[model samples]
Target: MNYIKHLNSVFELFTRDSRLNPTHISLYMALFQFWNINRFPEVFYINREEVMVMAKIGSKATYHRCLHRLHDWKYIRYLPSHNPYKGSQIQMLKFGTSSGSNTGPSSEQVEEQALVPYININKQNKNFNKHKLPKNENEVLDFFKKEKWPANEAKKFFNHYTSIGWKVGGKITILDWHSTAKNWMLKGEEIQKEKTLYGPSQKRDNLKIIKEKDYGQPL
Candidate 1:
């Protein structure tokens, strides 16, 4: 198989595949590397832990899900090994142009070959609009320091957003994360000022009085 041609063809397919997410692509590329190492074997055995590390997938559940999805979509043929000592089997489907073949398949041929649905241009555009999250906590910390915000606040911001899948309000996608971090900083400052003005004990007492007030009496 022509490595470059295969990659080009597969990537073109990936661009049109809306069902695939980043994790699926990452896992597939990792498997491709292993295939290359094995000299483009028709079939290969893969250890789960090694594949997971290569794909940067932390959870085993995620790894299996993407692998099974790829299998279901006909990108590869997967055969699970029930034995603990043996690795699983995989056979990558050939998508590259062969010596006797045309440069690219026709539209109908491509559809019939992979059973992929019609390309969704709007979904691809929406995926493009998503903001990229920090690779790790250190990146978040570095950005916070560059913005002259407290170093400790970076951890708080990173933790909150990461826990919520880096979304705004846990529902809306974050388009620009730097703006969100700055807003957190401003909110932190306002909270600090409130604490200074009211004192912790007085603030608690004020909240208690408000909660205990009788609404039945005339205003």
Candidate 2:
């Protein structure tokens, strides 16, 4: 699906809708991410606790309230499974396509276009990871320092990732460390811009992540 167009359609329709509060928007976005990961599947089961964390909701009532509100407002169709084991099934209706029925893409479309999601765990000791990074911890620090990145930030990246074994989403391997660092620099700059644009009080969160690899082997 055309992601930008889809978002535009939602914005065009929902810009004036009073029902869409900040909390609702956050929950919808959380579901939207799952929809993307599931390859735009209309119907999929989800873990409640995981989703709540993903949405940054502290209470089940707040989470369910926004979820059902989205459903009742035709943003999604929710089939509640009171059975925790069964979990709840959610079907996100395509925006600006049709009325709130299950008019979704076929399995073939999903398989062909959607990215499969997976999880990984660090197998090393609690403070170390077995997976190797493309660059040494010191090398990464040097690169960031050379790139004019902050020293503390550089150390923060090294410490966090080395401890976690360079996994993403807990366990996924990062294929390109250089690209990740590039993105990190970009993100830092972006956050700096936001801070400047919005004023000093809008401080960005301080967190850095880095990973490790065996010495002298091809990265």
**Candidate of highest TM-score:** 1
lDDT per model, in order?
Answer: 0.67, 0.57
- Alpha-carbon deviation at 94 in model 1, angstroms: 1.0
Highest lDDT, which number? Answer: 1
lDDT of 1 by residue, 45-136 (tens): 66665566566666666778789988877778888989763457788777775663533223332332222233344644554455556889
In model 1, what is the error at residue 192, expressed in angstroms?
A: 75
Candidate 2 off by > 4 Å: 98-219
**For residue 98, what is the lDDT in candidate 1?**
68
Provide the clashing-pair count of each candidate structure: 0, 7
True-structure Cα RMSD, model 2: 17.7
